[model samples]
Target: MKRSTCDICHFSIKTCVCSYVVSPKLNNKTRIIVLQHPSEVSVTKNTVRLLTLQLTSVEVYVGEKPSDFTVAQQIAKTHHCGLLYPDQNAIAVESMVSNSQTIDTLFVLDGTWKKANKIAMLNPWLNHLKKITFSALPENKYAIRKAEQSYSLSTLEACAYFLECYEKLSAEPLHHLLTGMIHEQTKFMPEDVKKRYFHEDD
Candidate 1:
């Protein structure tokens, strides 16, 4: 039998987190686009799915390359778009924070580190855009996901941090919502799942 999906959050009934989905007012000119891998769409723990539900203006596209996502490619071409990838050539988000240039759009990769790398490598158009990356951040509270580094943050966390520091917006609301999500998801995750991905050492 097919699982029932929540109309609001578009998550399976057993996994729907509509309760924690708050309507955040993201009235800004900068557009946030999430380029997700198709494989991530069905993952119960995917944060980008939950994130798009809360933030009204955010857009999500599924594909490994920009050519496969027409709108994302068009936006990259037409708008002053930037890629939120930490390639060696990427400029620190901190430096862009004070720059006079206005970024009308931002493209973020939504997948695991390896998966995200694959997306970046496949999308050659992305290399031409302004490569943007963040400084080291605090430990993530995404209890179900492990970080390769102490500064590794979940997709939503990175979006929130970027908005707070670069857009002069408050990340408190997003943080509050995500904290509740982690708490709920953690309660249901199997011990083995927790051990492998949420290892304290990671």
Candidate 2:
């Protein structure tokens, strides 16, 4: 028999994260398109799910290639595509942090660094987009999973910063939601990990 799922979060009812959802509506020119690898979708700690639950107008495409995706092709053709990848050619988003110069669409890759690299390499069309990056970002909140790099951030954190940079907006609701979610997900980790994130010394 199949278990019931939460209608909103789409999680198993037992694991429904409705309480931690930070549903804040955004009205901005930028339409965020997330290209997600299949592997990241089932991970409970993944932040893309939280982002979708919290924000509106976020288009998510699941696959490794642009042709395999439904919305990615049309999005690239119609709008100014800005990829939030930290490549050698990527421009720092801080320099373009003005509401005057707007981005029509922003594409974000959701997966490990290796998976994202593989997707971009295979999808040659992605190379044509304007690559953007952020600097001086705060440390990632995910203590449950270790990152390969010191500057690595969860998908939700990246999106939050993106909003702040492009639209002069703040994601306070998202911040609180993520804090609660991180605490709950890292319950099995050592006390130091949780303390490092939540303690006054932090």
Residues 1-202, model 2: lDDT tens digits: 9879788877666666789865445554578899998899888888888787777768778888667775687779888779999888887777775555546788999898888778888888888899999866866767656677888888888988888877777777677777767666666668776665565565
Q: For candidate 1, what is the TM-score?
A: 0.86
Root-mean-square deviation of candidate 1: 2.8
lDDT string, candidate 1, 1-202, tens digits: 8879889777677766778766655564568899998888888777887667667679999988657788888888888888888878887776665256558788899888888889988888888888888865655878666666666788998888777767777777677778776766666768887676565775
Question: Candidate 1: where are CA atoms >4 Å away?
Answer: 148-150, 189-202
Q: What is the C-alpha RMSD of each candidate to the true structure, in Å?
A: 2.8, 2.8
For model 2, give the RMSD to the true fold. 2.8
The Cα local distance difference test for each model comes to 0.78, 0.78
Note the clash tally of each candidate.
0, 0
What stretches of model 2 exceed 4 Å from their correct place? 1-4, 187-202
TM-scores, each model vs. reference: 0.86, 0.86
Native-referenced Cα lDDT, model 2: 0.78
